[model samples]
Target: MCGITAIYCENEELTPSLLYYSLFSLQHRGQESAGISVFKNGTIKTKKGLGLVSEVIKNSDLKNFESKCGIGHIRYSTSGSSSLENAQPFVVKSKVGTVAVAHNGNLVNHLRLRKALEAEGSIFVADSDSEIIAHIFSKSLSRKDVIGSLEVLTNLLIGSYSLVILVNDTVVAYRDPLGFRPLCLGEIENGYVVASESCAIDALEGKFLCDVKPGEAVVIKNGEMEKFKVAESKEEASCVFEYIYFARPDSIIDGISVYDARKNMGEELARESPVEADVVSAIPDSGVTAAIGFSMASKLPYTECLIKNRYVGRTFIMPKQELREVSVRLKVNPIHKNIEGKRIVLVDDSIVRGTTSKKIVDMIKKAGAKEVHMRIASPPIISPCYFGIDMKSREELIAANHSVSEIAKILGVDSLSYLSLDGLLKALKRCGRNKSYCLGCLTAKYPLSWSEDEK
Candidate 1:
């Protein structure tokens, strides 16, 4: 997945630095690339590179862009190769004017749409699905205005997307009909803001307004905001993984607190699979909230038994499996004093390939833990995710090929238990998020129809 942010300020000049800091808050969403595009003096200026937000957008670069409105993006490539050209807020010159686009989520019909555009003699610059949006917007401008163009584009698209488009001074944001990704609106001092999460809005000291409804398009211009219905879906399939793993714990997505949902997941896990242990310890960051709940429910003391290396990025998101395997130790280390001689209940979000989980359990054992009981807050991920996440093949998923008992033996844990699908739903309901969710990875049942070749 990716993080996207847009801002429209009426009373003061837009600070690119503020956009930079906002992207910093969303750094967890993506680390491969960072970019920002500003509408200044009737032209859209953009700067982007393949690196972390701070590495790509320096303090000196911020001074180069000045405007009353702009959009920013942090990308983790799921649709395209990791290259500078694929980095977003992709800016292009259109017949209407200069239009820059930033997008989160994937399009299942990207190849089909791209082929159709190419047959019409459209030359593509970037390989990303995001560029398809810019091309569609540019082509639609020949017949319709910005809003109407978005409507036509949204209708033709078949997949998950939360998009922010900048046309001159107007900023348009829209979520796909399925609402597979989160995008919300916020009220800034003299204008408005739209971002993939409310945390980005809070980073800019903006007041969160509400989530942009599924199939809804919002336009912010000249300090005024307007909302439009672009398309409709019979049922919304918001990604549950956002709360389980992706989003920042501090962020509230689609009216649910991410931190609370995670905690509830841990509590439900304890209720469903109670474990006897001296201490409940998280696998760090993602698992911390759940571990707290697990500790409270099981009446086990919670401790920071695993110390994470602040310098390490997420090992699972690393591009190569070998790199992921080698980097596990660099990412976390067991606190010998806390974990030694203790029967540890190791709570983690989910195990994808089992490589990292195996290494972590081994590390804790070597640290003198009597026995390691692995507890996953979510159900086993047995299928690939095509919407936006990087899990693209079932062969790469350990759960798809192995049983729970086999997995536990493989990891060398005393026992392993994953939260049941029903348990996960109960936790989400506890957080008042009873809406339909995309559990395709857990059940191999997708919300949208797709060709066998796509999988």
Candidate 2:
């Protein structure tokens, strides 16, 4: 998944800086590329490149991008090559006007749609599925009916998407009908903002308004906001992974705190699988919150047995297996004083390929730990994600192919257990009859169906 933010403010100069800081807050959502598109001097000017937000769009770069309306994006390559061409907040010239689009979530029907568009003589500049939206909206444009154009755009596409588009002086943010990704709205002084998560709004010192509803389009123009229904409402299937891993813990999604959800998951995990160990420790970063919950529930002394390198980016989002392995080595180190001569219970978010977990277990063992009992806060990921997550195939997932016992053996742990599907759902507070979240990765069932070609 990627991060997208859009702003419309009365104070024109503040827009660029606000967008920059918003992108910086949501940088964890994506690492491959960053960009911003601003409406300046009666034209939309865009600057984008292949790098982190700080690397590509510096605060100094905002000096010349003074505008009242702008959109920004940080990208991870779920559907495109990691290159400069695919960097977003893509600025396109359309017959109706100039539009810039920044999108989060994968479009399942992109291949067929792209081929069809090509047959009609649409030349695509970038291979990313996000670009497809810009092309479709550009073609569907009617200067007097922006919402009508969006309705047409939504009807043709199938799959998850949370989009922020800057069309002329107006900014529009829309979430897909099924809402497989998160998008929220916030308010600033005489202005409004929309982002992939509320934390981006908090970064700009704005108060979160609410989540952008599924099948809803929020339009901001002339410092006023209007809401419209652009598609038929369906069952809300927000991505469960957002609470488990992707989102920053401080952010609240769909009226639930991400931190609380993770902590609850840890509590559930401890209840489901308790191991006798001297101390409880986390894998670092993502695992820390859940580990705390596990500690609170199990009454085990929580200790910082592993210290993470602040400079290293998350290894899971690294594009290549070799890169991920190398980053895992460089990311965290075991504390000898905490790990030595003690049985350690390692709490982690999830084990996808088992490569990082195995290395971490090995590291603790080498640090003189008596034993390592692993506990995962979420259920086993047995299916690949089609709605923007990086996992592409079952073969890439260890749990998809191996039993829990086999996985524990492969990781060289004393024992291992994952939170049951029921436990996970309960922790997320979706334990009732309705399935409000997507568990496509944990269970092999998805919210949407696709042809073999879409896969």
Candidate 3:
């Protein structure tokens, strides 16, 4: 749901602009809003807003900042209403200095937790799940412990999270016990880095340190590092969607190659749903990987039938169905030549809402594709995700509302096939998890023992 970074430098060379540049490396991870907090003099000053990283800061925007230890965030807005106040790193001024927190992932029991804290006179500024965490850190002074306060907060919360807390001068990184999210450690020439993904590390000439383990909290102080491991929460169920579609193709999560895993998903899709097609084509960007796998498996030459316009911002508000009509064409345009009069096998990661798929099918047909067979590498996305990635209601999902064949006809595809529950499980096994992978979204069987595990 968000990308976060924190670094402690040995020199004043770590400027706000530089931090923004480094955080920009993970910009693709989130695009709704961006911001940063700097620990300067004895206070943490922050600049955050509802825009992309470049839109949020300019060369002169940070002219007022003077900090060495800082935290930066790019949010996709899974937890809160989209507003300036919801942007992070959330800062609170306390008697013991300032505590600023930037967090990734969603809290499952956020509403309940917020109500409980509010009953205790805890005032919240934003509708985000992250505000509670900031409040907890603010009160860490009363408990006379930072880690203990975090532990108390973690216990009271549920769902995925990877948090970076900048307490005056120190950077503390922690992940939820279920390992439902990813946070990694990186080392720069002058300092250490902690981010939601490793690509951010490579962007700054930082050496790749291993991932921040599940249920672990790592604190970086001066030139030393300390770690504390909390008990695991239920089971490890890192969101399979991260590997399937969300994380960058170049990144690695839990030792699985994002690109490789996706390719396997596509290959498995081909094996499970063999179709006769003259050309194999992908939707673009992430879909390109799966298309290659499908091409390899089918022995059909892969063609670039569709090209995506990268400039479009993430998540468009379709005020009317008429405007939504052009979203697919605005996002992707068909290369009529390759698709003309050919049997095309279309590959995409998943179909949440059918609008895009329906548009894509129409585009292909309009481009003169003889037959368009749609294949999704992952199973149909039925339920809404509570732990991040942004699906507000199960009702919004096409799969949840319509049957597979019904969806295929609605989309106007010659045929449609979604990776089966077993196919998805096999693909996960092929991803080769050091720990078990979560297929809850596919099977409706959460790895957690929680009551919500029931559909």
List, residue by residue over 39-94, the lDDT tens digit for candidate 1.
88779999999889989988888777877788999998889888888999988788
What are the RMSDs of all candidates, in order? 1.1, 1.5, 2.4
Candidate 2 worst ten-residue window by lDDT: 428-437
Error of 2 at 50 (Å): 1.1
Each prediction's TM-score against the native?
A: 0.98, 0.98, 0.94
Query: Model 2, residue 374: what's the lDDT?
Result: 95
Runs of candidate 2 with Cα error greater than 4 angstroms are 430-435
Model 1 regions lying over 4 Å from their true place: none
Evaluate model 2: give its TM-score: 0.98
- Better TM-score candidate (2, 3): 2
